[model samples]
Target: MISVKNVTLRRGVKVVLDQASVTFAPGEKVGLVGRNGAGKSSFFALLNGSIHEDSGEFSIPPQWRMAQVAQDMPETTQSATEFVVEGDTVLQAARAEVAAAEASDDGMAMAHAYTALYDAGEHDAPARAQALILGLGFSVAELDQPVNSFSGGWRMRLQLARALMCPSDLLLLDEPTNHLDLDALVWLEAWLKRYAGTMIVISHDREFLDAVTQVTVHVDNARLVRYGGNYSKFEDMRAEQMALQTAALAKQADKIAHLQKFIDRFKAKASKARQAQSRVKALERMEKIAPVLADAEFSFEFKEPQNVPNPMLSMLGASFGYPAPEDAVAGTPPTVIVKGINRSVLAGQRIGILGANGQGKSTLVKTVAHALTPIAGEISEGKGLNIGYFAQQELDVLDPEASPLLHMQRLAHDLPAHLRAGQGTGEQTLRTYLGTFNFGGDMVKQAVGTMSGGEKARLVLAMIVWQRPNLLLLDEPTNHLDLATREALGVALNEFEGTVMLVSHDRALLRSVCDEFWLVSKGGVEPFEGDLDDYQQFLLDEARSQREAAAASQRKR
Candidate 1:
């Protein structure tokens, strides 16, 4: 068992944990949650012995073998499989001993070392490493690719795979789902379920914590509070506790009234027959989560669009993908990702894009956002179509060196005079607008490059809401946001009177904001027949099939 008894941990002058006490059993899967900057990472640092408690006691079994994903970006020429296989310290040590023994001409020592290596599962190490890489979204063709050849996010995935490769008594994962797509996240959940070691994870993703963890540890006001259930149960307990406070009572009343109004209006207004059933389900879902959102410290809403356009866009046999390089030969063809897409995006429709990793969900969204033009067929955008797009890589469209104020100023300058009527181009006016999105005073002038990922994501959202777009194309917008901010976004999207198309691994967000799903798979786009649960099952089956295929290939070798 691991115990932190009245621990006082600090970083500089910041009191991260003050007399906090918490305990974990030998095989507990714990979800560590708190607001951003609430010392979740610091607490993790303590566990891994990267830092120590300034006062009181913190200890774990000395013999426990620990594994954690390295935060550093990997810069290596080693093949992906080989790199991951090396994560097993025991196996590596045993093999090294055997080599050393043989070099010294010690026959008995060599025999013992070889037996130790065998006991450490050296027989199937390659297959185990390959499985981990594949389960984390790597393709078969990329197994032998050098680690440094991949992008930053892909390299991070490799790091996660390597950590999972290690045989340990304890596993610590921090924001493990940030780089994963929906399909990959599903696979990871299953893998963690099968992990025998005691696990502690720090994640902003609500559904992820709920699915994989049986207990939740909340860092609140410099103390670690233990809860016996998952994240939802913790919220429920929080709601009950907060009910006793007068201020919280007033807030809850206001939110309840607000949700009641929405529910009443939603039932009365049925613009589309197909969406009626989904709306009913969404109302029930809202009622369940409203109290939780009401408990959040911050909130914002999307501005009403200037004009609403029905059937915001229509794609007729559209093929979306990357075009051939500019310097390519004349006859070189483009690489089509999602092809033969026939779909219509209407006003006020909430769509969740579903697909396995690398299956073109982002490609289709990019095409709609006009970031990438369709390689073939036609995209008929409605008259006066205005889109607010949030890329999966939010940094892609942002000027990292520019301040939040400067970004808004540039946006104001880019807008036509007619669109700039109410939103002023003046510095003070832009600053005030930025303030509405929580960018205040010094933060307004702070360079985005130095800001945290969550802040940058918030800046992107603020810019999107400022546009007053009729259609929102959000791709993994919640990747960097904390739980409270995510709840805020869910409420904001629910209140927005516009079309929404989102691609995210955060199931909670998907359930809250989206009523319909579009599947981008097998190089085509089609309406998904079922809900997120069904899609998760599909992903699981696919993962199992992949594992079997990979094992079979390994056997042949």
Candidate 2:
């Protein structure tokens, strides 16, 4: 349904896409993969016509409409329903024309309006809208909520719902699963599976890509390479391709060396000179294979302090919930969100918190970090426990006006003066710390506002690591990270000797880095001894049990 041919996109002097060609067929789900800053978002923007390429041939079939789910939500004060309804401009106009005709009592206008309404299938619009809303995880009551009232994640969902509601032949989604919970992600995957149009999604979630996409389009070194399978298949194919290329290159190198040796040895020999020259010419004409090195991997080595005692953070009979207004005391006992939470983070414990969205995972992390006081029960810290907390809303703690260096300097200033004695001056220490986080040279001087989301996250993490805390509390730490960075952080965390309490939806990272699972659900915390897959199976079993219990209850009723 859409084709890009010889597309060359440039940002200033940097070439993002060079003679890249790709095609999407109807009902095709294409997964776009690349490392961070490798022009995945730029490619989407070019396809969406939000930005024009320097030189390219992009084709969309005539009468084929397109919609893009943007990473940033558009600034708007409109109600969610209004925004979604407005997405279908023709339908909205037809409805308005129908209303006007009915008000004026014009017979000809009424006939025209009725025809328009019928042609547009106005009766089906409401049902379609409701389906889109629910599919994107919005409740019925939230349909009328102002778009501005929702957080960035929810607002992105609203934008996606609006795009999905539109009658588009092609959909362009960039990082659509970044903010989605597992349930919503499943819904989106199902929707795309049954969708009648084409879709191209740029996402870092391997599982989502595998579940939704049939083709993988890789953007590497300013070129587009298509792999005819899901992500896992693509990985296998890519590895084989690299190995073949390496072997071919090795053979070519051996041939070239042998030919050169022949030329050197037979330069004065009349009989062998012609054959040697032919070999030289063949070598010159041969297309040399470029080395297919794997993408650069990020390695995070956290410099944590040594030898901390057990039970870095512990809680007993903990209960936590946001306080309702005193005048609005109509609920029963304020509806405790989490209770009977008995958990401990020993010196070597690597615990992962898992649950659905808005299930008090963040609240539990805050309580463990001592950022939130539990309404009931006690929390205790071991002796000499140093804590490093990485909150989900990292931007809230960053100063927009400060440079990266300045931010680190301020953080360093808060450290004990005795520790700073051998660490050089404050500016030097900050620069050194920034370098450790891969923000060297000009990057350290850039303002925090100008930094990318990944950069800011890394900077915050670097600051935390500099303190060398004995215990760490991380909430959705991989939210803005690319695959390489996520793997790097996971490796670092897995190797760290300190206690860790993490809340994340990245199952791969959790499985690799965590030793146990602390699942928050239905107003309580349950400790499970296993990896993410085990916890996931536990959830599935629990869900099945709940369904059986409900059926039994219904039969009893």
Candidate 3:
């Protein structure tokens, strides 16, 4: 069990936790939730011993082993499997003991070290590491690839795999699903369910927390509020509590007013002055109940498109993917991720693209966004079709050195002449528009590079909405957004009048915004008949089959 009593924590001068108390039983799966700056990460740091409490007591079992994914991106030439295997600290220690014993030529020590290595399951480390890698959306062929070869997102997945490979009694995961696709997230949820340890996670993905957490801990007003159920349950209970608090506050306000009235009327007269003084004391002694402040909700709207093109775009036997490497032979053919795609996106259509990572979900979205060309066939687009694309790599579209005003100024001139018309790119006009997205005052002048990831994502959305395109193609747009912002995005997307094609791992967003889903899998694209629940089961079954095949192949050798 972990116990925190009247703990005071601070970062610089900010008191993130003041006299906060909470308790956690062993083996509980906890979900930590709060607003963006509510210190959820700081609390995690406390558990991991990165910092100490400024006052009061915090105690955890000293014998408990801990595991956490490293935040730093790993740069190494080590094979992916080797890097993950090294996360098994006990196994590594045992191997080191064996090597030392051999060097000393000690027969008894060597025998003991060999036994320890065997007991540590040294022989199974590679298999365990590979299992983790595969479950995190890596292909079997990529298992032996160098860690440096993978992209930043893929490297983060590798980091997660390494953390899972460690043996621990307490596991801490911060936004583990940020880099995962829906299929990979499903696998991770299943894996976490099977873990026999205490797990605490911080994530913006609602379905993930609901599925994995049995308890919810909220950080609010520099205090930790513990709840008895998952995130959805906490929300319901919190709402009820707020309603009751509001009524109580109203009742208290009436009493305070009545006391003040009595004191004011009698204090002037000598006969009742004594009673008035007593009433004043009473009023001063009364503990005031604070009014409930509603959580800030971030919201922005997509402007109405200048024109809605019927049959916005049609993909007739189109092949979506990338061309061969620049170093490849000139005659080499382009790589086709999804072929024979026959689909038409109509005006006001809502499409949710579904697929495992690297299975052409992004490839299809990129093609539609005009970032990639089809390897074959044709994509017939409507004459007036305009696209507002939110790429997976949003930073690519933003200039780090530029401010929000500069970004909008450039966009104003870059848009088609028809859309621009006679509109001026005045700084005040642009600032007023950016204000709708909550970028106001001095924030509009802050360098894009210095802003938080969520702020950057909001800026991207602002730029996209300004285009007023008929078709919105968003790929993983909620990666950096908090829960409130994500909810706001869902509401805004629903209110949007034009077509939407979203590719995201957030189940809540997909369920709310998408009217239909297009599954991009098996080198082809087709309509999915069922809902997200069905897709999750399908992904689980496929992963099981793959694991079995891999195991059987190894056994046969």
Candidate 4:
């Protein structure tokens, strides 16, 4: 069992965990949740011995081995399989002993070393590592590829695989789904369920937490509050706790009233069928959890566009990718990921983009959003089209040194007055606009480089909506957002009277906001007739195929 007893922890001048106590029995699957910057990561650090408590006790069984995903980008020339297999330090050490025994030509020593290697499951390590890699969406052929050849997100998946390869008594995962697609997310949930180790995962994904965790430990008010059952059950219990307090009940009533007004306003509009349904669900959920998050500081909505346009955008056999460099050799075509996309997006249409990682979802979105020009075919936009694009990589669109107010100011200055929706492009208006997104007062002035990932994400969202764009092209906008913020984003997207094309792994947000689905795969984009559950099954089948192919190749070799 792991125990944290009246532990007080701090970083710099701020208190993170204050006299917090929590206990985890062996084989317990726990979910650790909190708002951004709530010391969730810090607590994980403490558990892993990367840091120490300022007061009291934090301890796990000394004999227990621990495993966690590495955050640093791996800079290695090692093959992906080799890298993951090395995660089992015991296996690595046993193999080293075998090598030493062989070199010395010591028969007795070699026998002992071989026994140790077998005990560590050294012979089956490759197969186990391959399963983890495949489950995380790696192709069979890519296992022997150099680790450094993969992109940042893929490398993170590799890191996750490495952690899973380790035979540990305790497993700690922080936002493991952030880099995964729906298919991989489903596979991981299943894998974690079968894990015999005590597990604690920190994730903003509600469905994921509900699926993998049997218990939830909420970090709030500078304390650790443990709740029984999964995330949904924790929510119910938390709501009940908050409702019992007279002060919280009053606040909850006010929030419910605010949400009810929005639901009533849009309930009768046929064009807003999806949005209305989503809003209704949000309202119902808010009633249960509103008091629990009475102190939540983040909220915002996309502004209404000045002019509504039908058939907002259309792509005719369009191909999306970067143009080849000027100095490129002949026969090297532009590097296209998505091609031959023929689709029409109407005003108020909410489309969710679905694909496996590296399947060109981002490329398609970037092309449609006009962040990248199509390499072939045509993309036509409605007259006076205004687009707000959120890149998957926040740093790509945000200046690290700039403040939120500054980003808003620059955007207002760059766009024409008409695009600002008649809201004058002035500092005070921008300041007020920032406030709506929870960037109030000094927070508005804080440098973007110094803020948390969630803070930066909110600022980017604020900047995007400030222009009152008629179309929103969001690529994983909820990546850095917490549960409350993700819910708020879903509500805002539902309320917006603009076209939205979203690419995200967040199932809850996608299901709530999207009326239609587009699958980007096989080097092309096409309308998907089914829903998110169908997509999950599709991923499982794909993973099974890869595993079979891997086994066949091993036999051939």
Q: Count the backbone clashes (under 3 Å) in each candidate.
A: 0, 0, 0, 0
Q: What is the lDDT of residue 119 in candidate 1?
A: 99
Best by lDDT: 1
* Weakest ten-residue segment in model 4 by summed lDDT: 270-279
The digit string of per-residue lDDT tens for model 1 on 464-508 reads 888889999998899889998997888788788999999999888
Of 1 and 3, which scores higher on TM-score? Answer: 1
Model 2 spans > 4 angstroms off: 70-79, 88-90, 93-121, 243-294, 323-336, 417-430, 528-557
In candidate 4, what are the lDDT values of residues 1-557, reduced to their tens digit?
A: 89999999999999999999999999999999988888999999999999999999888899999999999999999999999999988899999999999999999999999999999997778888888998998888799999999999999999999999888999999899988888789899889989999999999998899889999999998999999899988988987877788876676676656655665554444344443354345455655676654546666677888876888978898888888888999777889888888889898888889998789888888888777889999998898788889997865558878888888888888878577556777888888878888888898888888987888888888878877888999999988889989988877887898888998888878876777788888998888877677888888888888888887776677
Which candidate comes out best when scored by TM-score? 1
TM-score of each: 0.96, 0.79, 0.89, 0.93
Candidate 3 ranges with C-alpha deviation above 4 Å = 245-294, 421-424
Residue 41, model 3, lDDT:
95
Off by over 4 Å in 4: 103-105, 263-287, 293-295
RMSD of each: 2.0, 12.6, 12.7, 2.5
Give the worst 10-residue stretch by lDDT in candidate 3.
285-294
RMSD of 3: 12.7
lDDT values for all models: 0.88, 0.72, 0.85, 0.85
Q: Tell me the tens digit of each residue's lDDT in model 3 across 1-557.
A: 99999999999999999999999999999999999999999999899999999999999999998999999999999999999999988888999999999999999999999999999998778878888888888888888899999999999999999999989999999999999999899999999999999999999998899999999999999999999998877876775675576666575565445434433443332133332233233223221211111233455677778889889999998998889999999988888889998999999777889998888998999998889988999999998898989998976668989999999999997888887765567889899989988898999999999999999999999888888888999999999999878866765675578999999999877875676789988999998877777889999998888777666655675
